[model samples]
Target: MSAEQLPALVVVAPLVAAPVALLARRALPAWMVATAACGFSFVAALALAVQVTSGGAVSYALGSWPPPWGIEYRVDVLSAFVLVLVSGVATVVAPFAWASASAELERERLYLFYALYCLCVAGLLGMTATGDAFNLFVFMEIASLSSYVLIALGRDRRALLSAYQYLVLGTIGATFYVIGIGLLYLMTGTLNMADMAARLSDISSTRPVLAALAFITVGVSLKLALFPLHLWLPNAYTYAPSAVTAFLAATGTKVSVYVLLRFYFGVFGTRIVLEELPMSQILLALSVVAIVTASLVALWQADLKRLLAYSSIAQIGYITLGISMASREGLTAAVVHLFNHGITKGALFLLVGGVALRAGHAGFDRLQGLARTMPLTSLGIVIAGLSLIGTPGTAGFVSKWYLVLGAIEAGRWWLAAFIVATSLIAVAYIWRFVEAAYLAPLGGATPRAGEAPAAMLVPAWILVAASVWFGFDTSYSVQGAARAAALLLQ
Candidate 1:
């Protein structure tokens, strides 16, 4: 299909497959349906990315209706890049789900789980693609609802509590988002982002506009789990099924970050957020706190899954730090880290999934001497871990390098130093796993810790391979992010 058709297809494709997955019940036939849906979404995202790169920004009026009057699905390089990240991660995570699900989920619920997964993907895609502010909330609810269910479906009883926590926080986030959208509509009498942007320019300094900004920022920060607002994340990741962990870890908060970008840069305009107000300072300070605090917490985690979960908060801090820089370089770093960290976290979580398959849990004590039995999986974890630490020649380095460059450009030497300092903290937490897996004995408890089934390993390795590949061959992702940043700044 043409690029213009791609947006509708992106949303509809998954929605259609979701029901088919539900109907495919018991036969395990839903796997194919889910795979096909994700595959189509992936291709659509790539097509959109290609079109955005080669043809520039494209917008589709829903039902041929113009914006501010009707909904618009905007596909700039920025949103397209995020679409690619989200859909691509969903597609990759599905295969891992096949094997991981059988062990962690009830047989009958597999189809239901996958159906919800597609719904979550659709919701996220809708959130990113739609140019309508109200429509964004609609999609946000769709994604949040499905995510709550997916998280709760974990085998452990704690999964229920984790999901409930996420639900409460997510609901609050969505409600705040709606309140903000309502405030914007009240001020501008329009639901479209671009239209609102143009109208909001006049009253950018008004109390209502400032209030809306505060509401939206807090709402998105909660969704993104920025710093102290991140209470729901550790439990959500640690107790959820491994495949769910991989998918949510890779795309969930990243999507929230994209929402922040859309509102801060696309709707409110950078002049108001960065200059008219003090967004940069607030974001920068919070981001630094998240990096240091989250890492400190991660260093003390005994469960490998929880450790990576805390690390995600720190990683998000890097992305937010980039946004706070508010320079082209900083935005570029934020965008690039969004992708790089997605793959890094996905690989790490998927590796944890593999360990779960073997020993039925991912506690650090259980993973001792796993290197001897699960050589390939452990090696993949090592590579991903190295990337997470921003080691040279890894995907993580590119973003951190750009981040440091952005700080230098902004003349914030201490910020750059803080970036490096946090990387050491990353190394410290990652090293805990490295030591437990490679150096310590298997401790008689993990005799069955041979290796995960091939299904799990394949998907895990794909992410690991991409982490290494992107680390070395940065021309594509970097260029995409740089161009996307320029458009966002414009």
Candidate 2:
């Protein structure tokens, strides 16, 4: 395909495959279709990233119509980087879903699961790639609605409640986002992001524009699970099927964060939002609370999945903390942590699926002596956990290093100290699992079980290996993040 066609193909491929998977009506065939579609999308995303990085931004107008009159898909350094991350995680998680879904879902419902999974992937890609504000909202709903169905497919009855809760909150968030976009449209007479950015500069200080910014920030914060608005996340993730949890945890919130970045820096510019308004201070304060409070809450959780869910909030705080600084190093830290945390949490959640398969649950009591029973899976979790704690020579440490440097560059010594202090909280929770798996002996009366099959183990370890590999070789993530940061600030 030509470079111009690449952006549309990235979204269209998986979107077309969703209906095909649903029509297949057979579990294996549906899974094959979904996996192949995701793989194709990942390749397209990588191609788009390379093209944009080498050739500058790529914009494609639909039906040969140009921007401000026709819908356009734009790919810059930031959007291209996010496209690769979302598609890459979806591709890695697709094969592993087969084994995990077979175990959790009924045979009749397996095809439906694959169908929704494809739609979710397509929606995330579309949201990242679109240049129109209305188009972004459309894609956001497509992903969110599919996610509700996927979460409700869990074996547990509470999955229904979690899905319902997410549905209600998600709708509110989408509504707020639409309202903000509507206001922007009234002010600028355009829905294209680039056009909106150009027009917003003329009236950015007006009351309507400031109100639009407020609505958008609150709406995106709820969607991204930013601190106090994060009530929907833990239960939703905890009750969803393991594969669903892993996929959503890795890509869903990250896309929302991407939206925040696109609007805050790309459309509105940093000066108005970060300086004229109180967004930076508000985000910084909430991020600190999320890091400290969520980590403490995670330390007391009995269920392993729920523990990781809480830890996800803390990690997201780290990402937003970097963004709140509004400096070059700060934005780079945010982008790098977004990728690193996605892989680290994805690896951890995938391993939790293994624990759920063999132990029948992921509670700490059930995980005793798992090191002896599921050695490879346990090892993967340990390595991922170390990354979470920001141990040196791990992917997590690289992001933290940049974050601290950003803090220091801003002359916020107290913020730098707070970052280190919260990392210790991560250490406390990680050690909880380590102690349970290694020191606590298995009870003799417990049922016998072995390691998860190769399908699940392989994908989980691929991410685990990536955590170490990216840690030692930071060229792709660090350099891409720096370039993306510079482009955003320009």
Candidate 3:
């Protein structure tokens, strides 16, 4: 009820609703409970964002215990921005999930899907809000476990394999993260991030602290699917249920990236990681490799979901590229792209899901002539795809513009050129779908499928429209990212 409690409530609303939804024991009722909870969390996140933006950081100590000893829910510009993005996506995805889940899942499993969805949302929100290191790992597991189950609910048997692979890798990542935090706790005797930062300042050059940095970087990179570590993502996205893919593809990795930012800038400081250890060069090399390799792989994919899966990897490369620059503008670019790419990719995946609903498959072969049959869905895909290519007057362009500027500001002209050049690969992959839908003729024997149900179409288009709206009006995405960047750099 109090403004001070908004941060905790943002996570608690969905956490409490998960079990309540499960107890409902019916799909419709469970869905209503989940949706209501997500909506409430979204509102709380928005209010928290407003408070942080207007009044600066808001920290709430759990159980009235003072931190270093107590877990803290800290809302600053960066975390608040991410909180809004995660909760906002969950709110929109909740309505769209009803139609897609009912069609893809068994009646008995539908309620379970709703319950896991709430858990995932709660976990993501908690991860963003928490200011304690161990608390973050706890929330990360909550989200990761729920996500594994959601992916396994896919119709194909491969879904089980994909989920298993993700579970294995995700657990490894979490374990490494805990080990890193344990080392930090040993050095600082504190699990609170702010306190850890203060204590680490004097001992950052020590071997244990450096090892903690390595462990945390690799651990978070694995979770965020940073290139050579991205083996679990494509299959998981490819085999997962459409709604699950849309939700995870949009919010999951973005939150991981936020964690990386929190540790890199907020706790460890850029001087230690970026300068003292050559981390920027290492990140730059990996990011370039990810962009070039993943985009090329995406161009050759036969399945639409897999192509987008690879595309997500390439887009993440762009975000990391910005981070590697280690400039205020570069971090701002990374933050902006994190939000923009989430909306663009979310829209694209949701549209693909709509097509899957009507056509039963998202492969290029199945989607041939989709423009003629599922006109609205195809149109939404094209628009979102154009954004992916960083076309002017789209959300993606705003981020890309700042990325190029960041490279140029950092005196990396070649990097700027490479960024533009890699975008051509995006064009090629996007054109694959365009040609399949528009150029390929419809088979005479194929049954004509109409557009997706309004429930799905509306949410998909909402993100598509957001892509364009944010493109033209840069106030929220761009300016908020600038403020967030300033806060992180502090």
Using TM-score as the measure, name the better of candidate 1 and candidate 3.
Answer: 3
Per-model CA lDDT versus the true structure? 0.90, 0.93, 0.94
- Clashing residue pairs for model 1: none
Q: Could you estimate the TM-score for every candidate?
A: 0.99, 0.99, 0.99
List CA RMSD, all candidates: 1.0, 0.9, 0.9
Please, what are the lDDT tens digits per residue for candidate 3 over residues 1-490?
A: 9999998999999999999999999999999999999999989989988898899999999998989899999999999999989998898889999999999999997999999999999999999999999999999999999999999999999999999999999999999999999999999999999999999999999999999999999999999999999999999999999999999999999999999999999899977998799999999999999999999999999999999999999999999999998888899999999999999999999999988887776888887787898889989999999999999999999999999999999888999999999999999999999898888898552227688999999999999999999999999999999999998888
For 1-490, candidate 1 gives per-residue lDDT tens digits of: 7768787788778888888888888527788888888999999999988888989878988998887688888888988998998899899999989999888888877889888988988998899999899989999999999999999998889999999999999999889999999999999999989899999989999999999999999999999999889999999999998998999999999999999998999999999999989999999999999999999999999888999999999999999999998899999999999999999999999999998888878887788888888888889988999999999999999999999999999998988898998899999988888898788987665536477888999989999999988999998789989998998888
Collision count for each candidate, in order: 0, 0, 0
Give the clash total for candidate 1.
Answer: 0
Pairs in steric clash, model 2: none
**Minimal lDDT window, size 10, model 3:** 442-451
Off by over 4 Å in 2: 444-447
